[model samples]
Target: MAKKLSIIVVLLALMGATAAAQDAKAVLQAAAKGMGTEALKCITYSGTGGYVGIVGQGYSPGDDWPKVELASFSRTINFDARTMREEQVRRQGNYPSRGGGGIPIQGEQRLINLISGNYAWNLQGTNVNPQPAAAATRQLEIWLDPHGFLKGAMAAKDLVGFERYEGGPSREGGFGEKRNILAYTMGKFRIQGSINNQNEVVRVQTFVPTPLLGDTVEEKTYGGYKQFGGVKFPTNFHHHTNWDHEERPQGYFGVRDGGHNSFGITIANVQPNMCGEAVTVPAAVQNTAVPPVRVESQKLADGVFYLTGGSHHSVAVEFSDFVTVVEAPLDEARSLAVIGEVKKLIPNKRIKYVVNTHHHFDHSGGLRTYVHEGAIPVAHRDLVPYYYYAVMDLAPRTLEPDRLSLYPPDEFQETFVLEGVQNDKYTISDGTRIMDLHLVEGNPHAVGMLMVHLPKEKLLIEADLFNPPAASAPLPTTASAANTSLYNNVQRLKLNVAQIVPIHGRVFPWADFVKIAGSGKTN
Candidate 1:
């Protein structure tokens, strides 16, 4: 009886393999024919739609994504030449009481993006700059499009395969339905397509590299298939930037509050075989290159140093035996540079703690680098689960491995979360010197935001709250809501701040902040 059972299991496995192979071949052929993949050389689609800029920046834990308005949008892509161009005009909307760190769309502003091969550049009005990371991201976006992936997969049959599964909930069906998946890998990224029984591609999902969240998810869905000039295409489409989490060995977790990065339009026009077009690199962009990381240190007090040389800044505070650095901004490169500088200034002290101001991608991108140096991250209590599960544990750094990925897990110290329940303020002291981390209460910019204070020095360290305008530039007539909130919090906390050190801009007097914040008096 045992032998008979073994034979039955073997037969079932063989049947499943055979079914998968057959389905894969048939589905590819059908999709290729229906989409006109054979005759297609190049395609261009244009439409006017709305866009959201860095939607996650406006989101807080447990809150829905804030909404903004994009007045106009258009995009053009050439498959054969491997180029893409986008033009957009955007504006701010009446939601999400406050905004932070993104293109301030208060008035109508025009922006353009151009990508060719491994190069990317942006043109905002007259200014042009090179964007290597954006270009890499665009390459993935081009290949992951439903029609584009189908066409590419047909030519690379060796890398493609199919699997059958019991149906899950989909737009067409309510729940517990049967579905088929076509899976493939491109470089270090994985792509999956959901195919309906009619051999039509319903959805495509893939992962993209990110600075803050590690591996971010991108998913697009298609429907309303219609024939256009002898080829079948989806008339209605939608694309989400970071709506889902990448599956990890431990489990799946996402840092975003389930918000979409952007959405697509109902394509109004499609033109094929319009070739010979390429992106021309401007002289300014062609000559520009990334500069080496440099750190400029200014001694603010006996044991405190203001580290600056780039757009973002960090403050290093020396304890009796160890050092604490505030705000690890940007990526590994920036963090590594700051770490080297800290070591030089503070001679023999090891960096024992990194105090994160907030969880915005830009500010917290380099926290992992400090973790590699065995430093505990001191952040808000609300971000504990997200930091441990999503940021530290599940993030796949295959594209660019950091210190944590290079060494054993035991080499790093545990992360520290400042629970508001026990104490709204977290103090790190060594009997002589003390640094207090306080929650910026009632601020609309971010949830669980933190600011560092040195009472003895009369110094305050913050980010994205009120970036002081340069001494030569003019001040605004009215204060922004975010700035007002930060000012009110400072007054409420009764912090005796004499100087201000901001993460984004130059250090200025506390009186300048009060002036820009529209408060009648200074501290």
Candidate 2:
């Protein structure tokens, strides 16, 4: 009788533990549902706020880029889960209204409204009325509940319970693929929550993750809630992605203009069909440069030389004590070639500052090599912390983790000055000669773009806005709006530009830009 009783007690204890584990599993499932299941269904909200983006800087050791900041942006979204229809509208500082004068009619159309739906076309660019991918919505489901059971992957399961008794500390999270010298660390944090009888999660006390600027991280927090719709939503979203995490589908490069980069959806409305259609391939763009290229250098001004051929254009400047290269084109191999050429031109002079034009992946991707070479990157002011904390520090460190690994950690032995002035006019001068860094104002290229101004040569070093027409090509018969915008900027800044040297074109006189803008003519 005594042995039997002992056995029964042991069995009861095991049963209790099993029950607790099952409850935890249910709570986790609810959490996952909150992320995708519920959030995806909720719609029709308007929000007005500001956002920031971090770009370029560098990927190697000790290199950093600048951040782009924007204020006064608003959005409105409308969603119908039962019919799976969404609509969105967006308005920016002084930009004209988008989306057929307000709310779109017919079919599901909103931002991030991922229902297995097809694309529906409408007014203004591409209007996707019904997203075709919606057919697979049920199959492509994602779980967001923190404690929810994942469909597969034991690693994910383990992560959910890494600190069941008490919340674990927050570490840097990976965004996309990790790369060399890109800082990627989050602030330390912990969480506490309770599960209801129905396996629903409620009252989650989230310790905020800190956003690092250059080398500093700011701590933040969020408190989630269980709403009546059988879903949990982070009633408060507090953590900021290195880039602005707004659901809107448009991006502005420089200044506000009447042109709208509407990918078809707004805040309160979502056009999931428009999601995939947002990226359009510029049809007219054709690369005619030679292959397995070689480099050709030309002296544009005193201390400033334009290195062309070998696939890309790079401007090399002889600074007071070192040589500064404006842009590092292409990947490590290309950067290595650039380094070799710069060394040959000015023997023993170190390549100092690599001033990136913007943060697009293509333009600033090669920054890792500079970081490894111990060169500091001078970028826009807003991107400092993101470079130091989110990109370089915590990024993946193997398999071509970039040249910066040649050095040690915290050995960022350089200065990355990100400018903050939003004026149309700015200059970096060495007293005798002044180099103006003009914001492209209303450009759709990249935000906070810097155009190098050479006053003595009356030259402008720019990228993406306009390229030189081929030597054999005839002058343009029709004007391009982009060309007109570039001209407007020149007039706005009052830049006495004579020569226009694009990063991807043969040399051309500013008169050419004027002709293209003034009368749809190109030479």
Candidate 3:
């Protein structure tokens, strides 16, 4: 009797799932037909718009990504072949060049991005720059297109549908239209999209894994449907790369545009069914694989080790009882590797603090790993709110769970501590070993920029402020505004500096920096 009851429960659950799948299939078919994409297999669209220059490099913590005008933006999508190619010409005209995102564009920047099947690569003047890490995100993007969304949803056998109020955050205060939401899983990615009463795909959302935000939200909202040729297309669209927590999707978008907004466009032209044009996968891209995280450390002082081996670097300072790692860049893999190296270098000491120089995504990506290992984050005072809401508490990281995500403390404050930058300077000392953190002022880089000073060792560590030229590379005739500011600040603080250690490049003498920036010009 007990076995018969268990079998009955299983059969009932299967029936419910099948019913949901049938409903979802009908909804997808309606949307596809209404959007005039039932027979569409390929699409190409071109437009003019505004774009974010740098994804995570803002002037201040929590600030919106820097903006640039897209003189022209074009994309060609081959849904049957699972391919996409986009060309963007960006211009920095009239936009304030305050934050870093390839700011101060001299004239125009041309960018070509391509994706075919599971492979992705960028075209740099005919050179194939393989981006193995970008493959998943690029592939998922293909499904975000309105037509692509329907095709993907229809293909999934487990697709489900439900009704949701398309409103803002709250139930009482929020106001939005009612819409049908269809969702399904494609490989590792789970996709969901909203279809309005008109049977148009108004929004498409999906989660992608990242080092910093974990499972980051990527979304696109489409509107202003207009017929071009054989099918309908959206004339306007807003895209979000790192969407704010869905809890408050409407309120905290970002600065000027919205918190997570990356770019927007108003379509000028649309062309469908370009059958013969197919993006060929380059041999290099097709064979590319994500390289393993490698950390090579060089001893600079008795208890200090410089962690290198990648484009970014971190400094490990060992205290008698604890260890502090400065600059957790890239993602969990990078931070985990650096942590392993630090432990091998200095055994039996717990990591106590991770000093984040700024809030740039690349630099902050790996910070959560150290936090999971029980280290406090030392960041600029202005970064607390952003870190709490966007990075630590509110944002979801479940796509590819990191340590912190897998074992989060019951309460946010129980293990998460953002500590640093009091009165623009904070110092870490175990009475004998001391390191000073000073906030950089009047720099074009980041408003919460920090420079670490090892007073006793007479070594200054910084990021982006002054990336020293390679040993054989030539120094500039005149210092850039960023370099000049670093020099002036060094003089103003009267720091006895012997060597300048850059997070991006090898260490160089203070004298070599002076040769180009010693003019003492104030920025």
Candidate 4:
């Protein structure tokens, strides 16, 4: 009798497993039918929305991400072909410029971005340039779309699985509703979608690689579903970064600005199966490889060198025994190139210190690379904790391993913060060569920003404060408050300035700055 009962229990367990599998499949099918995913081979959507240049804007340590205005935007995607074309007309508002110079206020700026299969390129008016990394990212976004995700899962049913998920509390309040989740793996990315009671995909979550963060989380939400021409799509779309990394290491999450990197779009209309044009790669772009690192060093003084190869620039000052480099801009590739140039320019002298201007991603992204080279980073005292906890301490080089990740932690030294308490001034000198790092007071661009001053050379090097207008460009009718503040600081300090070496634009005389900033005198 006992053996018979055991056999009955085993049969019941098998039945439960079978039922779970069936439930998963049913949920996916329901979602497909509700969203009209089966008929969604291609789609073209046009909408007007704004986008913030989050990476380009500087944040004050733990402050929320800054905003940049995007006047008009539109996108078209072909799911079957795995292609996308995005167009935007950007504008500059009251927001302060961070690094890549201030946007032109005279006219609207147009940009066109395209991704077809494995190819990605950008077109600005008449210029076309290849962007391989951006193309890869765009491809992932296409597959992760609500309708696209459903169709892809059906095709790869062998690798798809579903489970009941308790999504915790709803945004309104109380215990949130339960959801059926469809999860799958595509290449290096892991994707999951949550289906609600209406059999519609409410949200999709995935992971993407980043230079600062190892594997960053990206979440997209869909709502206001409407059927257009026999295809159902979400009218309201919102996407966020670091959405699921709340409890993870600070480095893994990157930004804690309450989804400041997030953006939304309200769809005006959708055309189904309309996209079919084949994207042709330009000859110039197809033949163009990753440009070799080339640093054109201009000797500013006896021991000072200005390193310029790309749009961004860096300064290397040779000390009595070691060297101090200012502003490690861009990513690891750019930083590695700059470092190589520094080594060649000043042989045998180790890069002992790297002075960071602010916490903007573009300016500070290469700090890790500098740290890997055994250089101490000096920045605002408040930023040290964020950099240490959110950047250095949580080091897992799994995604794109750098020199610091490959080596033991013991090999690198600690970062240095310029304590603003005992005067907002930090200096590095060897009696003969002196460099004063002072906080740019009252500047609207960034917090705890440091301007490098060579008293001996009467030269001041700064970033984003005042990028001189091009020789052919006309002077603006009004000056930015940030530029005005920079002029005031220079006069307040009473430092004899001869030349102003801006990180973004060409070096200009100090007189040019005063002329543009209105005499550095109060109105």
Best TM-score among the predictions, by candidate number? 3
Candidate 4 per-residue lDDT over residues 110-180, each given as its tens digit: 77888877778899777898887676677888877888788767766444456564567865577876688
Stretches off by above 4 angstroms in model 3 are 1-20, 167-174, 244-258, 394-396, 408-412, 519-523
RMSD vs true structure, all candidates: 4.6, 13.2, 3.9, 4.6
Q: Native-vs-model 4 lDDT? A: 0.74
lDDT values for all models: 0.73, 0.46, 0.83, 0.74
lDDT of 4 at 419: 30
- State the displacement of the C-alpha of residue 435, model 4, in Å, after optimal TM-score superposition: 0.7
Per-prediction TM-score: 0.86, 0.46, 0.89, 0.85
Listed per model in order, the count of residue pairs whose N, CA or C atoms clash below 3 Å is 2, 71, 5, 0
The C-alpha local distance difference test score for the whole of candidate 3 amounts to 0.83
Model 3 Cα shift for residue 328 (angstroms): 0.9
Error of 2 at 38 (Å): 34
Error of 4 at 91 (Å): 3.7
Instruction: List candidate 2 stretches off by more than 4 Å.
Output: 1-294, 382-389, 413-425, 520-523
Model 2 residue 507 CA deviation in Å = 0.9
Clashing pairs in 3: 54-101, 253-258, 253-259, 254-258, 254-259
| 308-347: candidate 1 lDDT, tens digit per residue | 9998999999999999999999988999999999999999
Model 1 / residue 282 / CA error / Å: 3.0
